[model samples]
Target: MLNFLKKKAALIWAGNHVKKTQDFKLNAEIKQEEQLLMMVRTAEKTLFGRQHHFEDIHSIEDFQERVPVTDYEGLRAFIEKMKKGQRNILWTDTPLYFAKTSGTTSGSKYIPISKEGMPFQLAGAQSALFHYIAKKGNADFVNGKMIFLQGSPELEEVYGIKTGRLSGIVAHHIPSYLQKNRLPSWETNMIDDWEAKVNQIAVETEKENMTLISGIPPWLIMYFEKLIERNGKKITQLFPNLQLIVTGGVNYEPYREKMNELLGGKVDIIQTFPASEGFFAFQDDYLQEGLLLLTNHGIFYEFIPLEEYGKPNASRLTLKDVELHKDYALILTTNSGLWGYSIGDVVRFISKNPHRIMVSGRTKHYTSAFGEHVIAFEVEEALKSTVAELAAQITEFHLAPQVNPTEGLPYHEWFVEFEKEPEDLNLFSLKLDDEMRKRNTYYDDLITGNVLQPLKITRLSRNAFHEYAKAAGKLGGQNKIPRLANDRTIADILSEYKI
Candidate 1:
């Protein structure tokens, strides 16, 4: 009886959500303009606004002209002031919370989360689920237990404001309506050790009615492995009602085959694009190819053509100007007081009517050591194609430039952890190299011109990446290994574990 009641309520909510989404699609441009103006007006009196002439900003053009695009480092001074309990430094009021995330230059980055802007993050996640329910006409998953594998909810005070991992901070804000179905007791979630926590979670939820599981792809693989070990059965066999899997933090295509194998069959999956800055996009239509960009939400976006990025005269484009299939570096000016901030992500639009995008790679996370300029998207697509053709399965992989090789010319090096190694490893390497050259013309040119040799594959021992993460003190929630890097930081460390 309770299950039926929950399903009925979910369906009604989904119906209302669909109508609102339709309205957003029709007025996305206007809403985005309004969002920018409202945020400017709200923060006009703050220090940053006054410094940047926000009060004079009347249009997107004016705002863009007055404010220059910047990364976290540029705003570090104002954020430091806020951390010391300063008010109106960046926003109208002090931040309610600081969502901590790992940074490259700086050890830790604290992103302000305002009370008014935080709801949009939660709403974006709920919108994804509601869209699935509305389109699929199946709310049965809502009636069964749902698990969001996450970091500890325990938080520490940072000058009178709560601070923790984005996933941990979000855990505290789960809606009361879904609390009844949410799994892995609060006690279990608070465990600081990830492996220990997964063990406890497996013991507690294996026998329960788990219908929906949400997590990062790599970590979810760990949880699934634990569950499988406990019962010695496929995930679907253990939880016959399992219906949905929600994933984010990294691209899903690379891990899909292995995850499907673990589950014993394919299951409905929703991909989300979330960061401490904001919940940016999510897969709203299961049939659609890309994530639906949330235009009416708290964020106002700007795009810089990937080729033009870092150039002084680079064009910053608004929604009306974005072209389909062109890669652009994503910028955000949000209700949380972030203005013209480069969040380091690169996205390519797939649909324009109600804008949809695929995260191609990060602005900084690509290899260009030999002027080949190989991005994560190219390598992932190449690997996916090669894997399909060769009937091989991968557990994890990383790529770096082998600039100073012992014998041959400088080449790209791929360290791969294979779940099912191809019968002919040499053939697999050649095929992968051929596929990569097809995707990246510069890489092909380099090889043809004798500037570089074909990429070399270094097969890794099982659980190599897990050990790398563990040694680096990043063995848990939301921490992902970079797919491509110009430096040898990771590649050199991985060398010690080579098979």
Candidate 2:
């Protein structure tokens, strides 16, 4: 009953806060500056009081200028310090939990998400719910149980102290009511029995009335494909009450159309931007094109110009100072003891009044082969267009940069799986290449020999990629098949195609 009341109270508190923020109005610039000041004050209280890194930061400018920008590496060092029971460089007490993230770009980062950080994560989830509510203008459709396709928490012993990743930590914090019976009952140790977990989800979801689903896009896509194959129309026929689908952890644009089709074109979709470090943003309204910054949360924000790299003479902008349409890389100082940390995500301003922004992509998640720069968003858009034109069902896909040594041309190799094989694979590849060029002029010039030839597409056997990810111990729940690769490592992994 206490747990129930806590959840109910939290829901009410979140609902009221969303209403207040949505209704509050101020000059976009003024509002941003105010939020920045609040964030700095909070950071000073939380981070400065706890660590030596910001002990010298006497002012906001002083904090920015003196404190060097940090990434996951710095955070890891901090965690090591905590393990020694020493005072953290930022936090006074030990972190409540460490959020684990797959280190696709760099190495895996274990971010210290504090007890204060839980509110932001919860707010991010609430924002999606509020967006759904605001769109339908009613809560009538949310009656069915929601399923978060998350990693289970059963620990695997390496040295016997209990460690997995951020997913395990987050899973532990889930409202008990949500987990008492609603969560997938598969074993939690992901590395131990991924196949058992996947089989469990397949069997359990088949029996329940799952209305809302959340997870990384690639895994969800594969799960739905598996469901369709197993009990044809079971998704559409069984889950008549399913209404909303929330996804994050990777780009959704590539699989948006395909996902829409799988859901029978009746569900409302909302995208979120969350990381082990922080719960950044969520789509606040169905009509709103981008996510709204969680200003009242325990996170402070700063931005570096996208064009500037390698420590250029760029001034970081607070939320109030950010301009619309300008691309910027994010630097955050959160309550979780990270001070002026660069989370490595890039975002563009969509609005200022309520501080709405779109997650453009990641700094390292880009391809610059042949000098034609292509980020995840652009690639996602191109894939969406290709899916529409081909009228094809994409089971899974990955884009890798390939440089031809003989021709000295750099291009992209697309590894894709479709529901039905195309009659002319070469023609389909050409059409996809043409569409990508059309979407970005930089790609067009590259294809015309200024940089490289057109991209090459390789069709994989049905469910082949899924099987490979499963084999690699990456299948089940939230683990997704990588969608974009900037190097040949992923390409090499997928190259060994044996049916």
The clash numbers for all candidates, in the given order, read: 0, 4
Per-residue CA lDDT of candidate 2, range 1-499, in tens?
6645554554565566566765433444444445545545555544444344334555567667766677767667666666454443456456666555677655655566666776677767766676566555555434456666666676443222234565565666676656654546535334356555555677768767787777877777666766776678846676787777788877677677677777775777788887777788888776547887776666667889876743766778776677898778898877777776888788888888778888777777667765666766677777777667777667677888887545656668888877655677787788788878886778887777556777888767776787788777777645666566668776777777622
lDDT of 1 by residue, 1-499 (tens): 9879989899999999889788787778888999999999999999999999988999998998999999999999999999999999889789988999999787799999999888988998999999999999989998889999998899999899999998888888899988988999999999999999999999989999999999999999999999998899999999999999999999999999999999997679999998899999999888766999999888999999998899997999988999998899999998888999999999999988888999999999999998777888899999999999999999999999999999979999999999999999999999999999999899999999999998899989999999999999889988999999998999999998899
Task: List the global CA lDDT of all models.
Answer: 0.92, 0.68
Which residue pairs does candidate 2 place in steric collision? Answer: 32-320, 51-89, 99-166, 100-166
- The TM-score leader among the candidates is 1
Off by over 4 Å in 1: none
Worst 10 residues of 1 by lDDT: 20-29
Q: Estimate each model's TM-score.
A: 0.99, 0.85
TM-score of model number 1: 0.99
